[model samples]
Target: MPWSLHGGSHLPGCPGIMEEVDKILIRSLRLSGTEIPDEVQSIREFTTELIVESVVRCLRVINPSVGAGLSHILPPGMSARFRIGMSLAQACQDLGYQGEVGYQTFLYSSEPEIRRLLLFLVEKLPRDASEDASQPVGKSTTLHRAIAVAIKEQLAVPWVPPACRTPRLQLLQGSCLLKRFQAQPLVLPWESNLVPGKVPPERKEFFVKFLPPVSAQLPQTTSLVPSLLERNMAELSAAQDWESEWKSQGLGSRMTPEEYRQWKLQRLQRRLLDQLRQASPSLGPAQPGTTGRDLIQLLGSFGAGHERAGALAKGSRFTHTQNLAYKQEAEHPVQVETIPISRTSEQELREKQAAELETLEGELGRLVGQIGDLEGQMATLGLTLTQVEGEVRQRQLGVTEQEQTLRVKGRTVELLPDAENNMAKLQVVVESSAQRIIQLAAQWEKHRVPLTQEFRELKALHNSKELESSRRLLEIRELHERIRSAADEAKHKEDLYKQLLVELESLPKDVSRSAYTQRILEIVGNIRKQKEEITKILSDTRGLQKEINGLTGKLDRTFAVTDELVFKDAKRDEAVRKAYKYLAALHENCSQLIQTIEDTGTILREIRDLEEQIESETSKKTLSNLERILSDYRAMKQENTALLGRTRET
Candidate 1:
């Protein structure tokens, strides 16, 4: 149930979904020339090697730190193979696999289990942002991808144990990166104790006796801060280099200064907002209020004024024409006095003055409107300031209350050890505990008496039974050895029979051969019947022997009990003593008679077995073959003698 694909809902059960999973896994793992069946029923067509390699590759893709340490190939030795299986299973489990997992799950993998594991791994494969074909890759994205790849490559290498690692102390010690770029320890040279000729003797003694050296305080080799600082410095250097490059070349590459300035301003604003958000993530996106908008507009207006000034300076120059005109009027004062003024000109001058007065009144009204707007803005700011002040006062009050509570708790802790009432309560608790322990010990003794007796009795019984079982086990082992030997003998006889039959078939044929073959077949059939009868008789004998053994043991136990009872009574009466002696004699005689009967039965069984063996051997015609061989040898000797006599006579 745990192996059920919860995240991979579209996988395993359906053919289409399984196919998709298979294809994705194959492509991602680069399983070339491997074909997955279209039907789910045929999923087992996947070999163990293919499955292991695919799973290992998928794990690497998902989590290189764990997967990289595992071997893709199964090891030849059973123990090493088991270790690898366990490692892979553990790695999968560490990657949040909820399914049941063990070494057998990987080493002795089944189709359904493999399918589920593969689907899980495929689902966990890291998705690439560049997978979206619609979006073009940027330089930053490319750089980030390259970094990720490099890190993954580094992580994928299996780590060597510290004891097995090659020494690199010299390389690390002489490296410029460690000397120039490493973080320096935080020092307080200006402190009174550290300052030259200002350190107190007591302080120096404390430093030497109690405090560690500065190197130990902030270790450059092992401390996390140094590594972090080193990394930060590296990043800072890279950023500075990029900034300098941009200033020298990037700025000039732009079409105009205005465009560059606008881009720079936007970049700075974006960076400022990012910093603000990081500083206080709880505060979401900033809202553009009226005050902020007004400030932006004011800055824009100032920029526009500067642009206008630049344009004016580039276009035309200003001249002092008005000053020259005033000088000319002063020099021609006598001529102007001689000229007479008309009445019509005076009337036109009065009309012009009235129009000018109306325009001045309109301008004064506009200034009053601007003042009202400024006053309203000031009032809003005052309200905001009031709210902030109230929040600050509330925080201060909370801090003061916390401090007071801390002081009260501190005083209580300081006095708690010396409190007389508390000490008295502790003594009472200890006395009560001691009494409870004593009562429990007494109760335990009461329970332990009967339990100990029962345990001893059970232990004795267990030992007797164990002895009996051991005796039976040895008997069973002997029986097994007998059966194995019997089986081997039977097999050897069978082989001999087949070999003789083949030899007979290869021999020259004769008219009498048919009769001989028929006779031999009949003999073989009779031997088989005899063997069956012997087997049945042996089985029956074994059964009777078991019954005899049981009855004998029962009789011995009965006699022992009866004798014990009679003997106890015999000590009190002469009649009982006589009866006890008679009883012992009777048990002895009966045991002898039983033993005699068993011996007779064993002798009869052995006699029957011997008769059967003799019959089977005779049925094979062994004596007839031996007699014919003897006659042939005599005939050859006679012919040799006749040939020697003929040679002598010639």
Candidate 2:
């Protein structure tokens, strides 16, 4: 017995040997049917009973709230491999349970939660409660009640949490103060059950007694509470009207209440130093011997004792007006000397004719500045004797009466540099005959300026034809009366062309009878025969209106799409409703990520056998060479989901 799962094996290959029992019974009979294996020793006894029933339900699925009396706490040589579905694979390799739990694929799919955990534990199990009960893989009576009925049918009641419904139970039934004590915290309402003779009129025995007085036993206290002794004698008559103003100003009969409080504190510091010398005539004024330093800024602004310091010293006055000055001593006597005068005769002939008219206008302004320096040296020596007398009249007009600039200006300002080189060679022969007499007087003013503007525009057309008048003397006075009225209208048009040549030999005639020339030859042969039968019925009504609008937009979008691979029973009932919603959301997220990785009971079952080989390769069907081997299986499942989403996001 101990060899089946607890104490070990069914011998032949020892230690919980049936390795993943015929690979989970040929992947659960190829996920429950789909002929893939015709038999190779029937897939080796179907993976040795799916690895001896997943090592006899790997420790109730690795502690999923484990309890089902762990199959009578496992040992007994795996008690025939924990009965019915056998294989307690050596009690799950001696209890250190590894992964995968098939308990015959959880009792052939949760037989009503392993029969409600075999009627909840059913007293530890040596099997039968009418046998068929516990079934997380056929016939196991307990695994602590098939893991306490697959963890009490997998928990999850949570979603009902926010209980307060019905407008928050009518807002907590309006804060139920016992519904305002309409009383039920033990209701009585005159003992409620209504009218038992109006509940209370019970008369039995009676007793009257005279009980009263205690000063007459004493408790009434005030022997003079005349209104609390007239409010404490009106606060002792306002403390005797505050000592009756120093006892009617006689200063308490000459002082001694400690000298009448030091004569009312030196008459409130001499009426606050006469109200701070009548409120500051310069802070210095208070010094009539430090009137207690202006009684500390005038009794901290007037008002302490002595009838408020005798009304602040009868309204304090000596208002210190001082700033004086005035003087008066300088009265008589003083002296000093020396003086003289004269000069008359019109003050000395106007001082000698104004000193002879200022020395004759300073010798007439130095003889008019030496006659303007000899008229600027006789105007530059009369321009060098007028350029040596114009080079001796251009050498007497070029030796007509001259030569060599007339012998160099015939020597004057001493051969003025050979008369300035014979007056620069007779001024370059009078500037080359005055530039050919200014180019023949500018070509005689350019051909005499359009012949002097056409002789002044023909003297303005002889004074505008002397202001016009004759039309050749009125055409020779109307050519003898227009040649006698055109020879009397050519003798009256030669007798009206001889009476129209005798009425054009008398008669007349018509040209052509025309009804618009016979309606233009009958509209040119009826517009050439109704233009070829209206262009052949407008080309067959434009190709049947383009195939009836392309068959009404292909019956609204390409023959209405949802062809979902038409029938093989609607593609295997849509791939068994997409493999039961992708293998039950991939076996419920791979059994909650392998129960959060074996609930951290780590012994890494290679990422839970690679998430049960990605849930049997996502319920099959990806062909094209398995989509080219699932394209590097999505880059190794994106590096194993980025290393398990960074190990479950930290």
Candidate 3:
């Protein structure tokens, strides 16, 4: 049987299923803790909103084009709510729901139906909706996702008044960027060079200094295409420069492109600051006690006098040395003195060089050994560090588990004293629940027996009625076929009659056609007389039928009054009881008789209708036509067979 709100036994797992459905719906709808009640039974105004929003969201996920523009909330007005409910019902049906669905199913929904519908909708939701975010995505998709996240975050922030907002903070606020750009007058290179020749001085001054911003000059509804285009072009140019720099120099730099760019920006800022400082006036003159001279000037001043004294001393010393050298040369001029020189042998020199080479080689070997030992120690340290890290992670995990256990144990300890009382309460609840279940089962049994009997009785009645209807339908179809056959026969007979008349006309002028005409008139007259008789008979039958109906009703009324009066007397008197019995028997006999008469009348009507059909068919000469058609068909068949035989022989 189809499911009904008032009927059907609840499944044992239905509550659990409903809970799961509620969780999925709550999560998907993003309902806050306070927006909806903890229990489904407590839902009121929010129920309609939740259901509508969830259905719309699921529909959109399933088929965006079809679900587009569907309202996510129920309307306040009764008619509109009804319309929305009807639409949602239709949409669900269109999605191929097998359950019985109507506007009432949504607007006046019960818990079970709501749970079923929500479960179906959740199942219909796109699989990709709950896909893992950790799944790989393309650069474009990732970029778009990031952009969406940024925009969402920006939108989530409360709006600040324009007056209190900073430019950076208000980047995503309204059309601030466009308004900012519009507030500035667009200055072109050519326009900057334009001289005001024909303008008045006052007008020129106003144009230069007091002109309103571009936004004021333009209409409020004016398009920002030009400004946007300019901005995009500027961005594009900067992007091109960045790309070029990154490829040419940034890649080879020790820093990343971003870091390199930052460094360049810092250098540019420093240069700008230096330029600004030079352009500005000095703070004050140098102090009187302090020299303004740089290191170069101070060093030059100290070295100048020292260099002159050294030159003069060198000149005086040179003269004295020359005189002394002259005296020494005069004394030593006559002596050809020869000094003896001692030189080491070639073998001794080679031995000393070899000894030094051996010492240097030994030192190089010692350093190589030390370097190898250090490398081994470094490798050992790295292995030890990795082991230590693993141990630390394990300890951290253990600590976390211990903390969780401790927390659970602490709660258990807190509840230790009340455990017995809780257990007693729980036992009482369980006993009460068991008793309630038994009571419910007994009540259900009480209702079920009567309902089941009634259902079976109704089913039997329905089956009998259905069979009667089918029989009547068959009779109707048979009558229709007979009528159609009669019509066709009539048409054919009319055509044959016309053809016969035409043949008679084409006959010789001397041929007697008066007798045929007279016969046709006589036949028509007889048919008219028969029709008149049939009509009179039908009128008489209708009169009899009305009288019978009136008599039947009168008899039923008399029987009811007589029985009421006799039943009272029958209780006290034996003869009256016998009389009452007789009266009841008479009434039953009369009712049966009436029924027989009605059945007879019905049969008579059907017989009359059959007779009329037969008469029509007879008048149309249907039998003769059929015989003629059969004869022609046989002749055709014989001719075809003869033709086939001749062909086969050939």
Candidate 4:
């Protein structure tokens, strides 16, 4: 058998060595907060086993033949040293360090070797293989160029700047030389002036030599040539100034003099062509055929340069004339008498203006004060208006209430006579009612004793029936309670039956022992007997219920018969009572008829007396009363007319 390193098979007699190593490892694992495997028992024993196994593994890695002999690595006396060694190796391995040297370094040299070995390994490792495999940094190739082209293609533009030629980025290093020259791309406008106090000499020369000569050539179109040459010279001088100005400004130096000259020539030709076209508008818009040819002629025409020269000459001449005038004015300045106002008048005028200003200021101050006063008054008026609104609302409410009271008074006034008449009629009815009540009371007194006796008898009978009904109600309640108790008992028996069924189902079928079998058989027999007894009881109870029902039917029949006999007796009593009531009513009716007859006789006598009195009274005073009433009515009407006239006068 051979031991192996890095998870290999174990040799014979390695168990003891392995056990020692395991003990040390387990101890170390426990210290490191690792749980010991169950197969490793205690730390010391596990350490012993671990050390032996690790020693064997290490020895095998060193030499396989030595691994076959466990004694070579694990001697009999070096158990502790062996445990320590194996623990170190395990710790190193667990921590992801390679080889037994790592463990030895940790224990002996305190891991200086690990750092050195790490540095060495890092150095030995290839640097960024993907980067090496990729395109060399900063060394742009055709492929990079192709990529750039692809980018430009994707951008849908073909032009690339010289700055974009290299892959090396110098973001802030390069000068923005193109942007410096951006504003002066065509020509520098500063070239129009050479210095602060001096005019351009070329402008004067052109005015004298080229432009004045054009006045002589105005009669012939062929005279355009010399002026064109003069203009060309002036433009060339301007272009030179532009170039010099651009250089002085240090904007850009890359633009060539030839390119500048060509650009200026083209611009000058364009300007000349435009001016020529404007000057000769009768020619209309240039024909398409001559348009290109005319442009070519303008560019080629040196005479075209004379046009700018002539304009510049005219401007310079005017400026020269002005300068001459200015010089003459400086030499011979005009003098005129100065009219001066007296200091006293000036002081008086100032005083008058000051007084006016003071008055205006005072007026402004007063106006401001007035404005404040007006604002205060407006606020006071607003408050007053609010108070007035509240008061008006209150007055309106009071007026509405007064109107409602007036309406109520008016209605009362309208109803006063009707209320008085109703009172009189009600009084008369009450007197009549009093007499009727007296008569009815007498009648009621006459019949009340017998009715009271009858009522007393009926009340006694009703009280006896109520007592019987109360007894019957008590019996019925007792029966309902008994029935409820019987139902509860039946429910309890049903629960017990269910419980017995569950037990029967739970009992095993294999119980063959005499005691269990006998007990189960006895319980089943008892259950069956109980069931039979319950059934018998139920049957007996049903039979008893049937007998009770029969007895109840007999009792009901007997009660019904008694009730019928009682009803017959009650009916006979009721008939006798009704007959008494009828006799009483008949007696009352007779009395009422006798009273009515007496009342009628009295009424007839009273009526006869009233008629006699009415006849005598009417014969004596009817005419006299009518005459008095007519005279009084006429007097009242005259007095009312006089009162109306007096009210109208007031």
Number of the top TM-score candidate: 3
Structural similarity to truth (TM-score) of each candidate: 0.22, 0.12, 0.23, 0.17
Higher-ranked by TM-score: 1 or 2: 1
Q: Each prediction's Cα lDDT score?
A: 0.61, 0.44, 0.62, 0.52
Candidate 4 structure quality by residue, lDDT tens digits, 154-204: 567444465674432232233442232111111222344344345477865
Per-residue CA lDDT of model 2 for 30-132, tens digit only, reads 3322223445322223232343333223334343344234342222222233253333323443444343333332223222222222222222222222121
lDDT of 3 at 624: 58
Cα RMSD for predicted model 2: 61.5
Top candidate by lDDT:
3
- Model 4's alpha-carbon lDDT is 0.52
**Alpha-carbon deviation at 127 in model 1, angstroms:** 0.9
In the order shown, what is each candidate's alpha-carbon RMSD? 39.1, 61.5, 41.0, 61.4
What tens digits encode model 1's per-residue C-alpha lDDT throughout 1-650? 11223333323224544443344445434532223444423335566566777777777777778877877887655557668878888888988989998876765565556667776776576544112222334445556866987778756755665555445533323332354444654442234223367588887677667776555656555454665576567668866675555556554453354455556666676666656444432234555643345435434534523443221222211122333334544665423122235645777666766776686556545545554565467557656765887799899999999999999999889869789987787789899999999999899999999999999999999999878866766675567668868988888667656645544464446434456346445544654676698899999989988998899799889988998898899999999999998898898898799879889989999998888667645633457536644664576567668879999999
Reference-based lDDT, residue 405, model 1 = 100
Model 3, clash count?
A: 0
Show where candidate 3 strays beyond 4 Å.
1-14, 31-46, 60-68, 127-140, 153-164, 170-650
Off by over 4 Å in 4: 1-344, 422-650
Q: What is the lDDT of residue 93 in candidate 3?
A: 93
Q: Compared to the true structure, candidate 1 yields what TM-score?
A: 0.22
